[model samples]
Each structure stands twice: as structure tokens, then as C-alpha cells.
Target chain A: MAEKKMGLHTIKLKNPPSILSTATIVGPKEGEGPLKDYFDIVLEDDLFGEKSWEKAESKMLREAVRLAMNKINLSPDQVDYFFAGDLLNQIISSSFAARELGIPFFGLYGACSTLTEAMSLAAMMVDGGFADITIAATSSHFSSAERQFRFPLEHGNQRPPTSQWTVTGAGAVVLGREGKGPYVTYITTGRVVDFGIKDANNMGAAMAPAAADTILRHLKDTGFTAADYDLIMTGDLAKIGREIAADIIKQNGYDITTKFTDAGIEIFDLTTQDVHSGGSGCGCSASVFGGYIYKQLINGNLNRIMIISTGALLSPTSTQQGESIPGIAHAITIERSLEK
Target chain B: MEKRKENEIKNIYQQMVQKKVPQSSLIKDAIFAFVVGGLICDVGQFFMNLFLSFGISKDDVGYYVATVMVFLGAFLTGLGVYDNIGKYAGAGSIVPITGFANSIVSPAMEYKREGYIFGVGSKMFVIAGPILVYGISSSIIVGIIYYLVKVLAR
Candidate 1:
């Protein structure tokens, strides 16, 4: 098992876990976005028939997991492990969802990178003979996040242009030991990197260096260049962080300009959406990957892709107490199996 | 040496962030604040005039105008329109008595989900608490200072 480990922080999976199915559920705002057609469920209202935004967020994750399970006619009992998280205090969205799904759960918190983090862990579990099947899932709600992080939902305050709109969505993916293609091939876990960013509003800028660092490390560890993957997507760096990350990567001898994109940027129409930076939160990458990118893979349009989700680890109290925001990212490489 | 390196790193990253992150348009914000704020004040003035025309005393007119303005702010917030105005209006909508009402009512409304006592009742003053704390305490300090000055002059 030690020999499976790649250089530094990366590992090359011996028996890659194949993604059997995926389910993405998004709010109307995202349903109206560019990749609208890829989502399995587009909620009419954000409430999802729940009284509170927190409950609705949990319901979204629950519904996403059930829907993913239903896609392959798999039951909750069939799922060996459920790894999930969300951008809520105590990760209530995931914990509540776990209680409903009743699959042996591991509640994770890596901020917005939680989905990728879950997937990395789930894939490892499947590959190591620890589990035959595992589920990776996460969610985030705009209203819930705003209340917990910044201000009240109806607070009469202006957001800075650098502020990102948390993508209100949830997504779940089922990874199994047995599947035909689109396997989780490599795992690159990121280290916490802080460049002394104090502003919570401009998280993209804070997380950019971490995103770039992960990408660079993944490439070096695997001895693969940027040209290897069909696409390399960062989680929620949005417009500001995406540019900074790509620039940093280019400066460090790896040119990923053309092949690089971000889940935040692609999930919204930048000009018309009015989401200053772009879409973010845990669901940004989760929904996009489950809805859009997975479709591309299944259709054989994209043979190989690397997804690196960036996260800004900071609480309101931490920012209030004058602490710099630390950022982390996790990269998961999924490739279509070349076997006939 | 470690602190110096940390500071150097902080300085370089701050520079990059400043360059990349889009700045709020001060000119646009100023204009929006001015127009919206002026419009709100105009409504207050209109109410004051109408109340005075009804043979109400000048001393009582001020009370009526203030009450009406505060009511309007709370009302707009309930209708979910004040935040829309605040989004673009910035200080225009936020500086007025209406903004103060908004500051109180918005949290109460948001925390309604948590329950009436803990959520709405307790958190309602979360945002407005600081204003009251400083505003009233400062006035008391001024009052004591005024009294001392009067005593000293006598």
C-alpha cells in the first residue's frame, strides 16, 4: 500500500474506483446557467418544501444521494460508505443527510473542497478493499451560508464586487469497485497555504495560491504535464482566483492556460448573472462535476480530466479576531478506462 | 527572521489581491446613495409638511415624521424591497432611520426560522446593538461634560 503512494502528497490508485452514477440537483439560478441541461433535478424553489434554508440544504443532499443510488437501482444498504460534507456550521447539511440515508457515514469539512475530499476518500476506500461501493456528496445553500458567514439574509448591506455568490446546490456520486469506465485514477491531497489574506469577502484571491500549488504538486508527483489532462478545473476560484492561479502555474514552468477552467466560472453566466466574482461554495464543483463534466466523460468527449477544488478555511470569528484565511485544495483525476 | 519573511509574503500577496480583485465604483455608489438618500428625505419632508398643514404643532410634527420614516423602513424591509434598494443605494438607504429599522427587522425576519424567543427576539438587536450602545453612552458622556462645564462656568 505504501508503494501505491506517488511523490510527496499524491497517490496513484492501483485498482481505480469507477464512478457508477452521479446525481446533481441545483436551484433555479444554476438551472438557468450555461450547463442547465446536465442537471438531473432543477428545484422550482430553494426551500425544497422545507421551512428553513438549513433543512432545505439537508433535503437537497438527501435527495441527491437517494437519486444517485436510484440511478443504478442500488439501495442504501448496498452503499458500503457515505462520505459527505457542506459549508454549514457543524456541517449540519451533511450530518442530517447522513441520518436520512443511513449509510455508515463520515462527515467531512474542507469548506468548498469537501466534495473532492469526499471523493478522494471514497475512491481510496473502494481501491483498498475496505468497501465495495462508496458515496461522495456535499451541498451548500446561499441563504444558509450568508446567515452563518457574513450577515442575515435580509440585511441591508452591500457586498463587495469581489464577493462570490454561494451556489445553492447539492450533488452525490457513487463510486464502485466494479464499473466500465471513468475511474478515479490519481489522488492529490493539498496542504494548507496562507498568503496572509485578511479579507473574507475576497476568498478567491486567498485560495488562488493553494489551488496553483496543488496543481503544480499533482503534476510533479505524477510526472505528468498540463498537456496530459483534457481539462484541469479548479473548484470555486471563480473569476479572480482562476486568473491568479493560472498565472501562478504559468510562472512556475507549467503552462495550463488553454486547458484550465473553473467550476465557479462555468456554473454561471458572468456578465448577466451579476454574481460579481462567480459561483462558489461546496456545491459549485460538486454540482458541475456531477451534472456537466460527468456527462462529458460518459459520452466519451473527455477521456481524462483533473478536478481540484479550492477552499478558504475561515470562520467569521477567526476573521473578526484578525486571522488570515488559510486555503486548501484537493485534486482528483478521473480517466476513461482504455480497456475494451 | 520568520516574522520578516511572513511580512514580506503578506505584502506581495496583498499587492496581487489589490490588483486582481475588482474595486467597488465609488463614483457610482456615491451618486446612487445621494439620489436614493435624497428621495427618502424628500418623503420625510413631504410627511412633515402634510402633518403641519393639519394644524399640528412644529414640536409634534417632528415626532410624526420620525415615526412615519421608521415605519417605512421596517415596512420596506418586510416587503423585501429595502435590501434591493440597499444593494445599490449603499449608504443612501443605510444611513437613514429607515436603514436603522431595516437593521433591526431584517435579522428578526431571518432568525424567525430559529424560533421566536431565541432567534427573532434575541438576534433582532444583534446588528443594532452596537449603535445603541455607543450612541446612548456617548450622549450620556456629553451630558455629564455639559453639566461639568455649566458648573465650572458658574
Candidate 2:
């Protein structure tokens, strides 16, 4: 007989407010809809130049961290540790910012699922007695990323409708000792899953199956149905990936029709931004979660939310190998506790 | 006197290095670098789009884009754009074909003096040859698979 490998853990957020504030950073303007109050930070001020690339990223990251700290009224020194990273090289933008903040920091890189990875790690630290308060953050800049990942702005490459836009911004969150709000109760890390896809433009299609695998595993491990939580969130698996994830979940007979949502999908609803399915990058969730969702949490608009941040674990070497994309996802549960 | 002379020389070298690249605020410098780099690309893209709108065919877009990209890549590689973008975007530049173009041409250009046959010719295909092979092979395989699927469905 095969023993069950899935494990489950739970935590209750104290003084769980109904609504949490959420913020979104985009090219030059602040984002609207379900995000205004959740976060008050904007990248428009620091965003400059024909493409400030590294300068833009480092600036946005600092602003995002500053915003999250401000919203929660916590200083950098008071925070136990700063957890952050990005899709950039050596995750320098994150490390560099953390250095300046002078907070004890732990850097991480999870491609797109960075927000969830940071959240899960911060949750563990808070729950494990390692620290009482920790901040999780992530960022990606479009100009900087495009020049780095694809063509320079001058290359004039056209994007297909299936392609997802990487947003330019950063997001941060301060997770304190359980009594302040809903704390992360459980987390499930996903293995790298691939479907032999090589089209770099269509990431959602490549990442959907990975999302499904993890969601199913999370439900199995927790012995809970989709209806157990108010929302089920996937990080950055844009439109195509969301459809694939939904199909996979439905195929498994654990339907999440009413509740399933994606950070990448929702954030890109503003067409003026030209992002087909919304924004991607670790900052998609970090800023949205810290800015928009946190506001709703504090306002008592939403009580329990399960955030499943998703990541794609593809490197330049692997992509160049003609190998398919291997995606990884992580799920962290946040909800209100009775005692607080 | 000998030790003092060596020390003075070292001090002059340090001063020269500092003058070449001043140490500013890390966060400010990084942010400035990222934003400026991004804007330059934006301008380049705008011009590319304008050029494409002038009736330059799609397939040839690569040719046009390549000229600009090669120049930019060369400059960046020269001014250290590749390394900076690498720090910021990770696999950002290299993931694109332009990156492939840079990877092939830059090293070849640098080592052309080593003999065109051993250096330029050999190294030219080092980064991109396999991609072309895979691209062609996959198309064939995919075509076969499609045919099978269509026949089976019928």
C-alpha cells in the first residue's frame, strides 16, 4: 500500500477584518478596480526614462515595500525579515532593495509564483517562532523584463493574443504574529510539471496543468472541498492557464467553478494597459495581496481566503534546450481565527 | 621610499577607478538604470512600429528589428547592457531571438582575429544551430502528429 505523501497544516488570522487593502503598480499609472484601497502605492512617480530598466525596478520595489510597511504602520527595522525576489538576474533588485532597507532579509526566486513562495515562507517563519513579523515582496518591470527576456523595445516584435503581459511594479506585505488578521494556516508546494510546450509567448497554456496538479493535491491533503473557502486564487497563470486549470480541476470531479480566480487574469482586465489577461510576475500577487486583498480583509468585506500563488520554474538553459516548460505552484491558506 | 612610491601608485589607480564609475546610492542608481533602459527600449519599439506601419512586411520585421537590436545589443554588450539586464531581468534578453543573435555574433566578432574558420565560423552556430535544428525537426514531427490525429479522427 502506498502511504499518503500529502501533508496539511492550518492557522487562524486574529481580528480578521472583512476587507483588506490591495494596490497594483503598472507602467505609469495606478491600477483601478478592487485594488484602489487595498494599496496606495504607485510606480508612476519613480517610473521614468525611455526605459529605466534596473532603475525602475529598484525604485518600484522600494516604493512597494515602503507602501506595505506604511499601510500596516510597521517600520523596516520592526519587521523581522524581508522576503523578496523577482524574475531578474541574481534577484539583485530584490536583494539590493533589502540591503538598503537594512532589514534581515531572505531572498527567493519562484519565477511567477514568487508572491506565493514568499507568503508561504513568511507564514512558516511567523508560525514557527522564528519571527513575529515578516514582509513578503516581489516585482517585475515590463521594459526591463522585455529587454532582458525577449527583444529590446526597438526590436518591434508583435505579441499574439495568447501572450500575457508582465507588469511593472512591486508589492509587499507585513505578516505579524497571528492576532492582527487572518494568518496563513496551511501551505502546499507543487512539483515541476510540464506538457512539452516550447512557445514562450503562451505561458498560461504551459502553466495550467501545473496549477491543476497542485490544487488537486491541496484539496486531497486538507480533506476539504473547494466550497470550504471563500476564494481560490492562482498566481499569474493568465487566461489560457486558468482555462486549463479549470478544466483539469473539473476533470478530477472537484469542481471550483464559482470560486476559482487568477491574479494575472484579474489584474489585466484594464485593456488600456493592453495586457490580455492582466499582469504577471511575482509582484502581481505581492502587490495585489498586500494592497487590494489586505484592504478587504481589514474592512471586513471578506472573511476567509485561500491564496494559491503559482510559479513557472523555467530557466534560460532549460528553454534553450528545446525542453518544455516545467511549472511549479504553491498554495497558502489565509483566514480569520475565532480567538483573536 | 619604495613602499611609499607603490602606495601612491595604488592610490592613483583607485582614484581613476572611482572616477570612471562613481558609487551612488544603490537603490537610486539601480532604479535609475532600470527606468532609463526601459524608456530607451520603448522609444526603439515606437520607431520599429512606425517603420512596420510604413508597409515593411512581417517576415522582414526580423531584419529591421535585427539591425536595431544588433546595434543596441552591441552597444549594451559594450556599455555592459547585457550584464545589467541580466541582473534585472534574469533570462529576459537571452530568451528572445535577439539574444540568440547577440550570443552568436558577439563572441564571433570578438574572436575573428583567431581565424575565421576556427573562431567566427565555428562559434557562429554554437548558440543557435541547435535551435534551428530543433525548429525544423519539431515542425516535421508536429506535422506528422497532426496528420495522424486527423486520419484517426476521420
Clashing pairs in 1: none
Question: For model 1, what is the alpha-carbon lDDT of residue B43?
Answer: 98
Q: Give the per-residue lDDT of model 1 (tens digit) for A158-237.
A: 98988999999999999999998799999999899999998898999999999999999999999999778899999899
Candidate 2 C-alpha lDDT tens digits along A1-340: 2222245423332222221222345555335444544456554544544234676787678667776677656677788877888988899889878878999989998888888888777776776677877878888887667655664443323355566777766877667764555556667777777665566766776677778888888888778787787788887787667766887789898999688888887665546655755567777777667666666666776666777777767766777788767678888777665443
TM-score of chain B of 2: 0.53
Per-residue lDDT tens digits for candidate 1, residues B11-104, read 9878977888778999999999999999999999999999999999998999999999999999999999999999999999999999999999
For model 2, the DockQ equals 0.02
Winner by DockQ: 1
What is the lDDT, from 0 to 100, of the residue B42 in candidate 1?
100
For residue B25, what is the lDDT in candidate 1? 97
Using all chains and alpha carbons, the TM-scores for the candidates as numbered come to: 0.98, 0.65
